[model samples]
Target: MPSITLIVNGASKSLEAWDPDMPLLYALRNDLGLHAAKFGCGLAQCGACTVLLDDMPVRSCSIRIADAAGRRVVTAEGLGSPEKPHAVQAAFIAEQAAQCGYCTNGMVMTAVALLRAVPRPSRDEAKQALAGNLCRCGSHERVLRAVQRAADSERA
Candidate 1:
């Protein structure tokens, strides 16, 4: 096993990974105990395993642990807490954007990236940013509203 160092959620962690090619999702869930990134489609087609790698939304299921070395990885667990949630998270709650809640992690993470890149995105841009993420429960409208609400809050 080789030791890999990662900066996750603003914290530095050294983890033992037997395989360098092991998906980052495994290390995050099994070793680091971060469950926000789920395994939806191991192929990375679904965005359930989304997380922010250096402020960019990435599919944790397809990325190798070795590749994530020294990068800033932010999972949903790191995004916010009950006391002070991230703007996107607070918006999701305010907009009631989740149904089954399986895809909310991806949606929120992706939204965070988009908002960071574009402080105020148009409706279409918000839709395009979330195109990769799938919500089986069909809460697309609410999700859009949540993104907009987050953007609005940021401007306020």
Candidate 2:
């Protein structure tokens, strides 16, 4: 077993994994007990297990735990709390962007990264940024609106 140190949700955590190639999602959910990132498709196409790695959106299900060592990993739980939700999270709630809510984590995390990179992205840009994330409930419209709403709130 290898002990890997990771910065998760602004906190440092030491996790042990038998295989260095173990997916980051396992360490996050099993070891660290962060459930915000869900496992939809282990293949990384669904984006259900998305998280922010050094402020960039990444698929935790595909990233090896060793590769995430020493990196700043921010799961959806790290994004905000129920009381003081992140702007993107608030916008998602306000827009009712989630139907089943399985994909909300990925959508929110990816939107946070997108907003950080492009403060105010057009609808097309938002669509492009979220193209990788899939919502089985087909809440694309609301998700886009939530991203725009978050952008507006950030500006204000």
Residue lDDT tens for model 2, 1-156 = 679999999999998789999999999999888999999989999999999999989999999999999999999899889999999999999999999999999999999999999999999999999999988799999999999999999999
Q: Deviation in angstroms for 51 in model 1?
A: 0.3
What's the distance in Å from true for residue 150, model 1? Answer: 0.1
TM-score for each model: 0.99, 0.98
Cα deviation in Å at residue 90, candidate 1? 0.2
The TM-score that candidate 2 achieves is 0.98
Q: What is the C-alpha lDDT profile of model 1 across 76-154, one tens digit per residue? A: 9998998999999999999999999999999999999999999999999999999999888999999999999999999
Positional deviation of 117 in candidate 1, in angstroms?
A: 0.5
lDDT of each: 0.96, 0.94
For model 2, the stretches where C-alpha displacement exceeds 4 angstroms are: none
